[model samples]
Structures are given as structure tokens and as C-alpha cells.
Target: MKKTGEKTWQLRLYVAGQTAKSITALANLKKICETHLAGQYEIEVIDLVQNPKLAAGDQILAIPTLVRRLPSPIKKIIGDLSNETRVLVGLDLRQG
Candidate 1:
């Protein structure tokens, strides 16, 4: 349950270097955050090429994966994030 002033959305995007998919994913994620979550969200982008060891921590199996770490139950979406509806659903902003 979200308490008073504690409903921030925490997101992490894991990618391998700056591939085309990774770049698109970041752009899409930023748009979603700005349009949907806005000030109530935070995004962290991690490049696996620079730090491969970090992937194990989040169990990232894909090159471009979006992980939602906050707002209670965690969720993940794997892909370039071109599908806006799917992204919204993954973030729990819409019915999945």
C-alpha cells in the first residue's frame, strides 16, 4: 500500500552498451515517465558492457530490460519498449 507522500516509482533500465534497441528503450521509457509518472518517478540506466557483474543482481537476461523496483510489487519488461501499451501495463499504469 502506498503511504502518504511515498508513491514514487523507481525504474532501472539495463542495457549492453548503446545499441539501437537500448537507445530506443531509453527514449520510450523517458517518454512514459514524463507522460505518466512525471515528478513521482526515478530512472536509472545501467550499461552491462561497462559493468557485466551488475546484471546478476537484477537477473537481467536481455540486453534491454526495464525493471520497476518501487511502488510495492516489482515488475520487469524486456524489449526495445516500442509498444507503448505494453510498457504502460508493465509499469502497472494500465490493466495488463
Candidate 2:
């Protein structure tokens, strides 16, 4: 159970495997969360290669997808996530 008004970001990263792009996305996501959300966020990595059924839950159509499942109104960003500015905007951490 979550406390009301207490922000805890629930993030899900959908990846095929430990590919370079998937690894990069995870690294970038961690860096951003550490810089912004810090302890206020939880990340769940889902390897579609191992569990392909999980992708349907999030409707994942691409590799290295970042899904923001908490804080209402789910959002997704697909890529290696190397572009910091774009990632920040995509995650709604900053206004575009």
C-alpha cells in the first residue's frame, strides 16, 4: 500500500536482453533517477526475451522502452536514452 501524497515513481523498463542499447538505457535511467527522484522511485526491469508475455501488459512495441507507471497518466519513452534533455522531457521531469 502507498501513502497518499507520497510520491513514489513506479518505472518499468522493457528490454529484449542485455544488449548495448538496453544496458545504456538502464544506466541513463538510473543516472536521471539518482539526480532527480533518488530514493523516491522504484525501477522494474523486464526482459522480453525471457518473459515475452510481460510486454503485452505494457503494450511494448519497441526495445528499450521506459514506462512511467506511477504518478498517474502513464508515459513511455523508447530509445537508448542517451539524450539527457529528451529523456528528461519525455519523463515529464521538466517542461519541454
Candidate 3:
């Protein structure tokens, strides 16, 4: 139930500090948001190394898990986000 022109998408990227995989995920997400979502998205990066407890909240069993918290039909994408098509589809950013 988001307002018009007001996106309520809440995204959280769980990573283990600034590793190569984490850096890639961050860069890929930033690029996607800028190119597609633009000003209609909120991305929060969580460092698991700093807070392991948060992992349980999301039921995360893998490193670099991206969780779409807000908005209905929550989704998740694991790994370094190397597959653009998969990431976009998982996040509902692109039509099938």
C-alpha cells in the first residue's frame, strides 16, 4: 500500500565486511538501483561480521544474501549478484 511516486521497497544486503564478493554485490546493486529504481529504493547493507544475530532474523544461511524486506512478496538473492537477470527477476525488477 505504497503511495504514488513513493516507493516502499526496503532492501538489505548482508555481507561479511568489505570482501571481494561484498564489494561486487554492493557495486551491482548500486548500478541496478541507479539504472532502474533510481530514487525509488532504499538499500541497507548489513555486515554479518559485526552482527551475527541479524542473520537469524532473515533466516540467512549464506553469505551476501540480499533481502527485500518491505513491499509485499518478499524476495531474496544470494551470492555476489553476478547474474543480472536472476537478480532482477528475483527482486521483481523485471518482467518475465
- Who wins the lDDT comparison? 2
Give per-residue CA lDDT, model 2, range 1-96, as digits (tens). 589745579998999989999999999999999998987888989999999889898899999999999876899999988999998898889999
Which is better, 1 or 3, measured by TM-score? 1
**In candidate 1, where is summed lDDT lowest over 10 consecutive residues?**
1-10
The true-versus-predicted C-alpha distance at residue 34 of model 3, in Å, is 0.8
TM-score of 1: 0.90
Model 2 accuracy (lDDT, Cα): 0.91
- lDDT scores of the candidates, listed in order: 0.90, 0.91, 0.88
Whole-structure CA lDDT of model 1? 0.90
Residue pairs with clashing backbones, model 1: none
Q: Which candidate do you rate higher for TM-score, 2 or 3?
A: 2
lDDT of 3: 0.88
Candidate 1: C-alpha RMSD after superposition: 2.3
Query: Between 1 and 2, whose lDDT is larger?
Result: 2
lDDT of 2 at 27: 97
Candidate 2's displacement at residue 41, Å, is 0.4
lDDT-better candidate, 1 vs 3: 1
Work out the TM-score per prediction: 0.90, 0.91, 0.89
